[model samples]
Target: MHTFGSRRDIDGLRALAVIPVVLFHFGFSTFSGGFVGVDVFFVISGFLITGILFREINAQRFSFVDFWARRARRIIPALSVVLVAALALGWLLLTAKDFSELGRAVRYQALFISNILFMRQDGYFEPASDLKPLLHTWSLAVEEQYYIFFPLLMMLLMRHVRHWRWLLFAMLLVSFGLNIAYLERKPDLVFFSLPTRAWELLCGAMLAVLPASKQAVKPWLYQVAGVVGLVAVLVAVFTFDENTVFPGWAALLPVLGASALIWSGAQGSTWVAQVLGTRALVWIGLLSYSLYLWHWPVYVYANAISIDGIQHWEAAGWMLLALGLAWSSWRFVELPFREKRVLAGRKPVLVGGLLAMFALAVTGAVVRSADGFPQRLTGKALEYAQARDWRAGQMKCMLVTSDKNLDKACLVGANQGEPATQLFWGDSHAAALLPAIENNAARQGRPVWLYSMSACPPILSDEPRQRCKDFNQRTMEQIRRLQIKDVVLASNWSLYVYGREDGDRKVLLNPRDNAAEAEARMAAALKARVAAIRATGAQVWLFKEVPLQRKGTISRLTSLARVGRSAEGLGRPLQEHLARQGFLSALFASMSAADPGVHVIDPTPLMCAGQVCSIEVNGHSLYRDEDHLSDIGSARLSPLFAPVLLGTSDN
Candidate 1:
């Protein structure tokens, strides 16, 4: 069995893994599977470490203390320096909350268990996962978890079996089976947990079990297979995305590919391995650990600070700069302390190192509290977080879940003096119109009944009616039973009016139509629903859909004022990046036809000046989250209710 890693190949592998991960982070269109580099590392680590275990057991020289000590020596000095440096640098650039989260990440990193920490933090595969600076540490945690149990398992297995091959095969089978099962039933657990990851390591162990004669097999066939393996992994990296279920059967392409290259055992003689396992590449690989540690934090910090996606060429420059920083850290901080002669193998140094790591971790967590770092400059970040509450009671909603539906709670204004009130009903986007609904009710001096459900449009179900049937029934029952006089129907009309024809589920998350079918369906649905709802005896006031806004209303106002656009509070018309998209425009094209009961309250004046929709009014957030308006933003409806709800207003 191999006792030590071929430093050149190992380094080459490191180079391969880190490059794609870095490129992907910079938002490169290619190398989506660059993330598989982590898997490659896992396989390499498993093979090398398992090989080490096999040699020690065969020679009877294995000692757990010494093994763990070597691990501490190899992992801690460089890791500690990176964490502390990241924390210090992060303090300068990060917001209070970002700093706070950085602190928590640092602490968990110190213990080598950040995967579990993060899984519980923002959810496993959320879009927000991109924001985490220390996310890469999950791989280290997985390695540490394996290290904790692997040596003992090796010791026990050696006692039970004389030949190591049988034992390795059994362990491989167990780990692989666990991975397959977890991938299907619990992918998140598989993503973060070590049990699911052990199989990758076992693949390496399997490599070590092969006899030396087998390793030296006819070189050309080995050369061909090894090259094929590496290419397969690269192809997978180039094509795959985060949405792919990883470490599953699909992962076999990359893992087995790496394993095949390893099993080929090129030994620097084979032409392909010679170029791949070159001194320069290996040298870069030797520093790959440090590079991996530094690259992610730099990218995350850039994103947190940038106003938008960093332009492509600008991100490329960051990669070069990150390489420089990593090389410097490796040369200056890691090499000197790692040597055995300087510290004389004393135990206190380890203790000191552990304590120092723990300290940095603590600093990361505390630095993001309400009064944490930069909060002294920006007041309390927690207080700024309070801005979400600005639109709280002022607007009533059907579901507190999504802005796409109207929630019953937001129409509180409609409950003004009267015990009984009018009922408002529609899909999620209807929530945005609640400010106007409540305003009109308050003017009428009566309460308004509230009913809202996500994706439950008021229109009768069309063609395929599989989902939300019971929800529609419940909504219909409530509308008929309530002593309701008026119904305000508002929605992301583009979603319903332009339904899908290809497949039932809407592939796009937003309300816009990308293809011909969605646009057509969106318009047809709006027309039919408005006409049908108006058919009811109730007075139907259709609030023309509100424009979807982004950016904080306050920040936009602040920016406009800085440019003197808001000099008289008349900011230059906000850019029309997105107009009232899809069906809302089509509905408006044929909508205004002097219908008395079917009144359409359009916020075109408040939202659009000329043709652009502004996200801010009076330096406030227009939408609380995504395209939905904030509590203060709902006040934009005040104008629509001028003659209907309140005497004067803004929507």
Candidate 2:
């Protein structure tokens, strides 16, 4: 039976794993690939935990009870405290929807299945994930889940297989192969699922089972291996970004690097080990587990409060705060529980851990059942909170991806028996203008058919989004069949021309085309679409895209109002909005000049007052969330629509 001594370098390695993650979460652009720290941690965990299991199994002293008890004591206490804290703070800060989501997260996290829950939601690195306080727990959940199955698998191998290392190597290859196979098709599953992640853990397990004497035979080899491993981890940290497809082939760098570092430090000391064993790195490493737990929640809360996003210096302050919390959690909660001072007996500690987890799960369920217990908010807080419900009751009119018949349910202006004279065709923006069209068309005694879909451009372009193509084709068929005369085209045009405001930085046309070429394609498509509409004897009315609110107007306004803060600078600048409109504006001008059937309707003049687009006009929010109009905002445009559709004045 072989027993391993504690390595200070391993603790320093923990520091290396955590610092980059903290820096990355804190929004430091320099550490874009700092997310690889989690991969490093995974390898370290596999090495240490496997080493313990291997040693115990060889000595014939391996106890599932004892192993689980140790895991419970190590993981449960600090986690419970963090959960309680998150519950308390979330109640105070989070909106009802956010709080409800938090409740769901809390339940999933308590069960140690948050990885599964998050898999169905946003990508880990997405901006939307920034606000989720419990997001980091997914990794802990993955590790704990591995611990549950790995020890049993290892014991079985020890009992039957004479060459157990070969089985481990084979399992590693299988898991790696599985990850590679589904890398592109199911990247999220590869990222969050245990099946694909098992290879990373097994990489460390392979190193642990190897003979220590064999590893220490050549001191120069350890030095070289350790240095190369350190460089590999650092390279992954510096070079990787959100665009990089991960954990298939890309994960090899950090996993192998961490394995090299662990193997080199097994017996003989390398130069990398000496550097890692320094007091500063070792101290940080000692607090690494607790630090990892605390940092993300701190960053999340900081982001939730700050409108523009947490500044670098403010993020530093939050990091310091996390450090203090980590130190306190480690010193008070973790150390005592680990040393058995809090729950002295193994059975007692195990019971206490189970009870605590159960209590947290119960609390989470209650929070969810109570619909986030919205009674915490009152008056203006409640008003702003409720403002987030910005759907504008138009879902029935918007043609979903699954919807087949365009004529069946998408009419907006009049009853089914009335022949539709006007057609509104575009994306969600066209749906947003439905209320005004309904009111105006009723006054004119003419039905207006609304056929719209979300994230679909109205243009007949060679863009790769087939859903848009299918919807537009069906809409054109309906227009020709009904002989619809007045056709209004509206869309969030910037998204197709310049990419999404929140997601992609710029538009991408084809794999081969540049931005200019893509713009040309968009312009040509618009012209062709206009000519086709004119051929059907329809006068095309193109509504200018609404000014986008950079800061989420309603949510931001609500958050600010809840704290008695003024939302003076919450709206997007008119100059920026106009600049984004430059290309579209020019295109519309050229189209109107060339075709007598085409008319441009500019909402910019009415929407923007002075140099700013007012998010709130006359105590009513002009925006529902960011870009889409609220019921009030849409109704306000009814007078504008009256003149165009009914050929009558507002009076």
List the RMSD of every prediction in angstroms.
Answer: 6.1, 3.7
| Model 2 regions more than 4 Å off | 1-3, 214-216, 390-392, 401-404, 408-423, 436-485, 496-521, 548-557, 571-583, 605-621, 636-643, 646-651
Report how far residue 51 has shifted in candidate 1, in Å: 2.6
The digit string of per-residue lDDT tens for model 1 on 1-651 reads 443655566668778777887887778868887888888888888888888877887799988876776677677777887787777656555544455677778878887888888767654345455557788899999998898898898898777867757877887778778888878566667777787878887888778756666444576787787789788789888988877778788888888888876766533345556666888788778788888888887776655444443578878788778888889878876676567643447475566666777776667657645434544333222323334443544334555443443224433564455544255566665665566556656666766655666666655545243344455556555555654446666665544543332222343232354556655665565566556555555556666656644322233232223223331222223443234253455455456464555567666577666644655444454555445566566766766654544322112
Q: List the residue pairs that clash in candidate 2.
A: none
In model 1, the Cα lDDT at residue 139 comes to 90
Give lDDT tens digits, candidate 2, residues 1-651: 133678999999999999999998898888888999999999888888999999999999999989999999999999999999988878877777677888889999889899999988877867668658899998998999998999999999999999989989999999999999998788778999888998998888888887656433577887899999999999998899877889779999999999899888874778999999999999999999899999998887776666566789898899999999999999999999999889988899989988998888988988988898778887665766665555556777787767765543366655658777678888888888877887887777767788888777777777577777877887888889898877889988876766665455334445345568767887988888888888888788888888987643455555555666655555678999999999989999999998877888888887888888877765456776677887767777776666467632112
Q: Compare the candidates by TM-score and give the number of the best one.
A: 2
lDDT score of residue 505 within candidate 1: 37
- Given candidate 1, what's the lDDT at residue 296? 82
Candidate 2 is scored at a TM of 0.89
